[model samples]
Target: MDKTLRRWAPLFVVPALICFIIAFLVPMIMGLVLSFFKFSTVTDGVFVGWSNYKRIFTDMDFISSLWMNVRFTIVTVFTINIFAFFLALLLTRGVKGTNVYRTIFFMPNLIGGIVLGWIWLLIINGILLPKGVTIISDPKYGFWGLVALANWQNIGYMMVIYIAGIQTINRDLIEAAQIDGANSWIRLKSVILPSVMPAITICTFLTLTSGFKIFDQNLALTAGNPARKTEMLALNIYNTFYTRTNFEGVGQAKAVLFTILVAVIALTQLAATRQKEVEA
Candidate 1:
């Protein structure tokens, strides 16, 4: 039976392996090769050495957008996780109508990114209009606007994960802590928090990646108006690829850099958090 299963497993896996190679691996290798040359299409690629990479550093728009995304990610990851953790704590306390509240909170996550952006845009602009400023009128406004939207979209989802973590905790440990005369704050720190670290790690990773790669919301909300101050890395790469002529190679180079940045940051985060995760 084992021999037969092993033989058939390869047959089943071969189709998926072929699809993976054709759909993902090929395009990735082609893009990397294209980044070293000047070409609008793969067939017409002309080698230009490192010129494409050099241009990216000197481009102010790209630098600004990259910087903006970093700042936004820092803000959103912190706020979203903090709020989600608190909400998770609140809902786990035998609160009335918790299921209803959970459903309501998670509803925003169901909205499409573009539609969510437009919804927030109208609401934000309506408030700022009375103050004689708009989300696009100032870089700070745009920055905070993105932060708020990220928190709104992600907090509920993170809360659900946190709730799961909290539920899985050993009640015996919590009871023992209480019997030892531990206060609410002490128990929260020594018991609940350490137990929930896995959930925290997952939520932080999701928010970090989402914040960096966000495009639809950025597009529908600000569209990088007021001279592209609010543009993010994804939008910048997109504009470089489609909006410019004879710069497809440079755009491809920017994409490779973006991939490297996200990979490094995510791996670092995982390493840092995994070291602190306690066994359940």
Candidate 2:
């Protein structure tokens, strides 16, 4: 049976491989090619060869959006992970109604991003309206609004991963650490945290990537309002592609750059975290 399954493995893999090529690989290749050309449509492109790339930085909108996105990603990644880790620690203490608390915390993640955005929009606006201001009234408001939305939505999910990690820790090891006179902070720093490094790696990767690729929340929450000061990289690419005339190539170029940027940052984070896991 094992030999037969092994012999058919290639056959089983072929269909999914074909689908991947069709669904992702082909478009990525095409987008790369189109990024070098200027055209309103894919077939009509004329090779401009780096002109679109050259114009990317000259657009203030793109620059503002990129900067905002960087800040947003940094803020959300740290805030979400820290809050989630502490929440996990709290819930794992054999607390009463922990299951109920976990359910309530995690329910927010189940909501759709667009719906979450609009929900927070109303809540935020309701608070700010008394001051005669709205989320879009200022870029800082929108930036913090995004950070809060990201934290609220993602902390629960990351908490669950952390809980799983915390639970897997050997009870005997913890007891031994306590017997050796290790305090709570020392145990967390030396024993529990080291044991949970795998979960940390997973949670960090998810939050980092999600922070960078966020779109619907940014759209529904602020829509890059107040002269596009709150714009993020994804929405900026969208506006550049659809709103502008004769800038499709530039949008494609921006997309290629965005992909590379996210890929590099996420991979670096994974590598760093995984190395820590190994050392731990």
The candidate scoring highest on TM-score is 1
Clashing pairs in 2: none
Query: Global lDDT for candidate 2?
Result: 0.93
The candidate that wins on lDDT is 2
The TM-score, computed over Cα atoms with residue i paired to residue i, of candidate 2 is 0.92
lDDT for each of the candidates? Answer: 0.92, 0.93
- The TM-scores, one per candidate, come to 0.93, 0.92
Q: By summed lDDT, which 10 consecutive residues of candidate 1 come out lowest?
A: 271-280
Per-candidate clashes come to 0, 0
Write one digit per residue (lDDT tens) for candidate 1, span 1-280: 8887897987888999999999999999999999999998779999999999999999999999999999999999899999999999999988899999999888899888899889889888988998998888888887888888888998899999999999999999999999999999999999999889888888989999999999999999998876999999999999999999998999999999999999998898878776765433
Every model: Cα RMSD to truth: 2.0, 2.3
Off by over 4 Å in 1: 1-11, 273-280
Clashing pairs in 1: none
